[model samples]
Target: MPGTPYFSPRLILGAAAMFGMLLALGIHILGQRFGLDLGDLWGTPNGIIPATAAIAWWLIAAVAFVGGYVTASLLFSAASGHLPRRLQHALIAGGLLLLIAAGQAASGPSPVPTLHGFYNGIVALMLGAAMAFAGAHFALARH
Candidate 1:
């Protein structure tokens, strides 16, 4: 294992970031294909369509990546103990879902359209898995 490269936390972060960016792009493409006006999601008053939609999309993606990384870390850490990994992941995923639900309620409505809650939930799950795998690999490398 001398020349073998070790897994780094950065790899997980980078993977999450890339996934987020892809998600953002996919959303945009889907919006255009379905003829859905993303301008509304950007909160444009006159609906004249500013560049804010692009910016907002990217911001959402960034948040998704960070959220995924954190959730994964928490789940892995908790599961590495006596708790089952499935239980730990489920708990963290559920907690994130609840947080998002509360946030949606408090914010009145989601700024981004197109299955906002569901999309984010999926992203969180993906992120959590990525982080868990990365963490596990890194931990193994040390042993």
Candidate 2:
């Protein structure tokens, strides 16, 4: 195993990020195609995308699904294939960061909504990462 390459966490993070972004952007595009513009979602005076919004939850779920997949896949591929506590924690942290970064585009286009967008993104990241790590932990526990 000395010369062998391990399952790279960086790759896992990238995969999760890509998956989350594609999902979020796809939803945005879908809304556009349906003639639902930004005005429909955040045209109000507050101009804030609420974390409780369907889009927010959708993005959160996407990150969670992707994060769990990547985490479990790497854990399953490890040489020992044993789930260590520290490894699990580290993977969860990585998943959190990946989800947050992937949601960077979630901060809507306008200045007013940008703040709320970032906040919603953070909320989504936290929930998504937790869901992902929990899923991976439970799944790996059975392995």
Candidate 3:
């Protein structure tokens, strides 16, 4: 383990922040232009926003994953070669999700997350992992 290469928290957190900002900006633009409510419109049986919102979220997720993978690759110096490529990417994506969970913990009004909120977070984070997996495939191709 002494020789094992790993990504730093600074690397993961910084990249996630940058990508998260991109997502926030995108959602902001969507909310401003279309006035779609993220909280209200998303879960209903008949959602208010078109499926395009889902597409947009997917695209943003891919971008975030790409950012994460690229950040890790840059910092870890393709020294990651010895590590299983899938494992390395999974670490990066998992780091991002944990960061998101920490963020959610800090932001929500309730001291403790409600059950529904926790459930939704799990679903959202899983979707993120899937997106990151796809992005990992794309990034590996470029590698």
- The C-alpha RMSD in Å for every predicted model, in order, reads 10.6, 9.7, 9.8
lDDT, candidate 2, equals 0.50
List lDDT for all candidates, in order.
0.46, 0.50, 0.49
Model 2 scores worst on lDDT over the 10 consecutive residues at 31-40
Q: Which has the higher TM-score value, candidate number 1 or candidate number 3?
A: 3
lDDT value for candidate 3? 0.49
Give the candidate number with the greatest lDDT.
2
Q: For each predicted model, how many residue pairs clash, with residues at least 3 apart or on different chains? A: 0, 0, 0
Clashing pairs for model 2 are none
Candidate 3, residues 63-128: lDDT per residue as tens digits? 557654564454345455455678768866865675565455445463223664454344445555
Worst 10 residues of 3 by lDDT: 32-41
lDDT string, candidate 2, 57-114, tens digits: 5544665665566546655655344556777788667646644653553344533345
The residue ranges of model 3 lying beyond 4 angstroms of the native Cα positions read: 1-42, 45-47, 50-56, 75-113
Candidate 2 lDDT score at position 22? 40
lDDT of 1 by residue, 1-143 (tens): 35434445555445434443434334433433333433445346876665544544444444444444554454334434545778767865765564555444434544445575456445534543454345434443443
User: All candidates' TM-scores?
Assistant: 0.33, 0.42, 0.42
| lDDT head-to-head 2 vs 3, winner | 2
Q: What value does the lDDT take at residue 113 in candidate 1?
A: 56
Error (Å) of candidate 3 at residue 58 is 3.8
